[model samples]
Target chain A: MHRFANPARFLRIAKPLTPALFWLGLLLTLIACIWGLFFTPTERLMGDTVKILFVHVPSAWLGMGGWTGIAIASIVQLVWRHPLAGVAARAIAVPGATFAAICLITGSIWGRPTWGTWWVWDGRLTSMLVLFFLYLGYIALSNASSEKGDTSRVAAVFGVIGAVNIPIINRSVVWWESQHQKASITLGGSSIDTAYLVPLFIAVVGFSLLFGALVLMRMRTALAEMRIEARMRRMAQG
Target chain B: MPHAPFIIASFAVTGVFMTWLIVSSYLSMRRAEASADALREQS
Candidate 1:
């Protein structure tokens, strides 16, 4: 794990795998969307509104998963001083924010149909919204610091702090009054029928892989940019 | 399927925007990589 902490080694490993991940993710996402749109049975209660899960649930999960990765990378950067960890942490911030915002927006859209309201202060909905704000705050605070070390440390603290909300987001439906429904699918067991479950799983995998590819590409660019900045500073001093 | 059109529209919009985000980000990163390489060459 730490062996790949070196940017050069990480890049070499990721470069070969990037194309494969991108194509596989693209194929899977397309298949999942087609399966959901055409194959899955419409809900007895919500009718076609059920199909929203094909996109919303996976994007929500990816949003959480991406932030979890950033938090872990931040930890590695702070504790082990892994050189590429900061790059990875920085790389994931924007995508994670985008996914989280998408999750909230889609949820609201789905809500307007299913619950007859576009906004709610329910536990799950509110917490998920908070998570999006947290992502924005983390990105903003990181950029606020002029010193690189200060920026990384500030972001890392925010990253770790924000992570505590993930479990809360997951369990919010269980613990409190929620307009949001309980997860049809769970890690331990899924309540969703196989008809809906299969495509949902495919979407999850597709989104995860796509997120991985994006992170890798962004990290590589960040690493390169940092190197260039360092060289310029050295030249200026000389 | 009371509101199939609305749901489908939302999904299509999200899909198109997401695809754009991914492509634009990729292109931007590639451009940055090129710039970095050029900078390295000059040094």
Candidate 2:
């Protein structure tokens, strides 16, 4: 982790890695999309509505996963003073928020047909909504603190604090009565049939790769901006 | 095929946001890279 603290070294590795992840992820996602949409049979109960799961589940995982990345990066920033920690955390905010919003919107879209409404104030839904708002606030705070170069303590603190919502989001459906379904894929075993589960799993991996690529891209950009600022500062000083 | 609208809408919105995030981030990277390069030449 500390090895990547040097922006030049990070850029060297990321330049090649970014497009690799992006293109591969896009290809896999397209494959999964077609497989899920055209080839599979609809669920007996939900019918075509279950098709939304391809996008919905992936978005949900990444929405939560993105924040997890933020919190981890924030921890690194606070603890080791890792130079790229703040950059990585900031890079995560927009994409993370985008996924969170996607989850909410897609879930709402799924809900309208299956559950007879667009949304509910159940624990799972409400906490996921909070996670989304937390992402928004993190973005705003981190953006305001960008000029600091390597440190954004306030936003880092917020990132860590916001992580409290993740567990709440995960456990909400189980803990409280809600229209949201409980975890079909738990460590014990998956309730999802093999036909849908395969592509769904692929979709998750592909989307995760896309998320990683986006983070790398944004981190590279942040590094570049930092370079520009540093150059300008040195020029003025000289 | 009954809930086609919801299914299509879900994927469509997901695609839209994914595209937007990618393009916007790429553009910013390009712009920042260009500026940094220009400054390097000046220095």
- The DockQ score of candidate 1 comes to 0.62
Encode model 1's per-residue lDDT on A1-238: one tens digit a residue.
Answer: 7888777888889887877888899899989989998898888988888888888888899888888988899899889988888878888998898888778878888888889998999899888888888889988987786567878888988898889999999899999978777877666898898999899999989988888888888887777778778888999999
Off by over 4 Å in 2: A149-151
**Tens-place lDDT digits, model 2, residues B6-36:** 9999999999999999999999998999999
- Which lDDT values do the candidates have, in the order given? 0.84, 0.92
DockQ scores of all models, one per candidate = 0.62, 0.80
* Alpha carbon deviation, residue A183, candidate 1 (Å): 2.4
TM-score per candidate, in order?
Answer: 0.95, 0.97
Best by TM-score: 2
lDDT, candidate 1, B1-43, per-residue tens: 2678658866876687678768977897788889888988988
Report how closely model 2 matches the true complex, as a DockQ value. 0.80
Please, what are the lDDT tens digits per residue for candidate 2 over residues A209-237? 99999999999898898899889999999
Best by DockQ: 2
Question: What is the Cα-based lDDT of residue A208 in candidate 1?
Answer: 82
